[model samples]
Target: MNIGFFNGEFIDINKAVIPIDERGHQFGDGVYEVVKTYHSVPLLLDEHLERFEKSATAIHIRLPYKKAELKSIIVEGIERAGLENAEVYFQVTRGIAPRNHLFPDVPPSFTLTVKPARKIAERNYESGVQTIIVEDDRWAKCHIKSLNLLPNILAKQNAVNSGNFEAIYEKDGFIAEGTSSNVFVVKNAVLYTTPLTSNILPGITREAILQIAKEEGIESKEERFTKDFLMNADEAFISSTSVEVLPIRTVDGQIIGSGNPGEMTKKLHQLFKGLC
Candidate 1:
């Protein structure tokens, strides 16, 4: 069984415990981050931790440990889990209390879990994935990476139920993001993604891609584009801890860029893999 860091101890997943009164369980008062690893080496850990701290502060939740200490714990957890490549899921939730909507007068609880890295299939990554556009009706605090994700869950499941890989969320004809990933498009030889706003999640992979673009001399723009623009793009892709630079061949059954992965996407995919 996978070992999990719950409360303060590393224990079997089956034995890991959480009080039913935990605010995360009752009111979803928490934030989380997912960090990707490759061949046992954590990637972009500092970036992820920076975001983790930001998320904690955004919700007024106090982290139980400092960033350095948490980093050690995450490294230890990865070692104990025996994962050469994996995704680490870490969260901090306001501690347990009696059933109530008010904040608990206690320190927040921290939990870190490691799982086998979920790698996209070779065919899916090569041939590209599919996405469906759904209305963006998520909470305004999406930039916080909070635990409240029912709206995203429903939207993502709706796409999955239709055999799609992701749900590109849109608001008033403009694309905000995916239910769980950052959406981007390539048009006229330039990369376009949503700007940093409360309307979208701040994705670590997205940042890494921007850095890669800068280093590789590829132009990028953080500008909001409409769903119609996405539909007309030469290529589209989504980024997340789990799905890194995942190409989208079709959106809502409409073919994207000759119904295959575009050239720029393949080049970026190769560049990201090289980074790993």
Candidate 2:
């Protein structure tokens, strides 16, 4: 019974299909955004949509509809899903055309899908999660939320194969981010994370955490830190729309600090939950 918005129409998920020649499918030419709903309301929707538009613009893909129209479609699809807590995923791609690397003259195609939200295991929050550091092999434009996610997928799969919760991507020993989240470390009671650059996505949740920290008088810095610093930090965590704030207890089998979620991490997690 789930409903989805596909190419300007709302239809049953089963009936929503894309043409084989669609650029998103054929060339991975698309941008996407995932918004999580709490009490049937999307959190930081405006920020997410703004980032979506920026991503599309970065890749020269024009959105088929304006932000207001897209927001309406998201609301309609979420209502059809009938889930108080859900994840709304939407994407825009260059329309279907003959297989070619060159830009096509056709209009763009946009789709929205809503589904029940996935909750993280309580154990992960209580006992904290383990992760491994992997070499970042993604392209230069990691800030764009494009469909080209093969590198991220492989890194995440590597984490899964190793029986870990996530993969922390590092470029030349400097931590960039997680496979699907932003990375943060606490040292001497100061929270530090990567700078806003082309190396990492400017996560909405990450921004919220920093804002909360500022309001709470918690010291934070946006600067790159090396693997040695991360391994020896007092605490570490990852943030994203889905995970919110997840504690990192260990990395590459090396225990971080006392191998437990730090006081700052817990405080920030509570603040983030309140916002949600």
Best by lDDT: 2
The residue-by-residue lDDT of candidate 2 on 1-276, one tens digit each, is 356888988887888398889999999999999999999999999999999999999999888898898889999888888999999999999889999999999999998899888899999998789999999999999999989999999999989899899999999879999999999999999999999999999999999999999999999999989999999999999999999999998999999989988999999999999987
| lDDT, candidates in the order shown | 0.88, 0.93
Model 1: how large is the Cα RMSD against the reference?
A: 1.1
Once fitted onto the true fold, the runs of candidate 1 whose alpha carbons sit more than 4 angstroms away are: none
Clashing pairs in 2: none
TM-score of each: 0.97, 0.98
125-238, model 1: which lDDT tens digit per residue? 778888999988888888999999999999989999999989999886789999989988999999999999999988988998888888989999999898889989999899
Clashing residue pairs in candidate 1, if any? 40-84
Among all windows of 10 consecutive residues in model 1, the one with the lowest summed lDDT is: 1-10
Q: How many clashing pairs does model 2 include?
A: 0
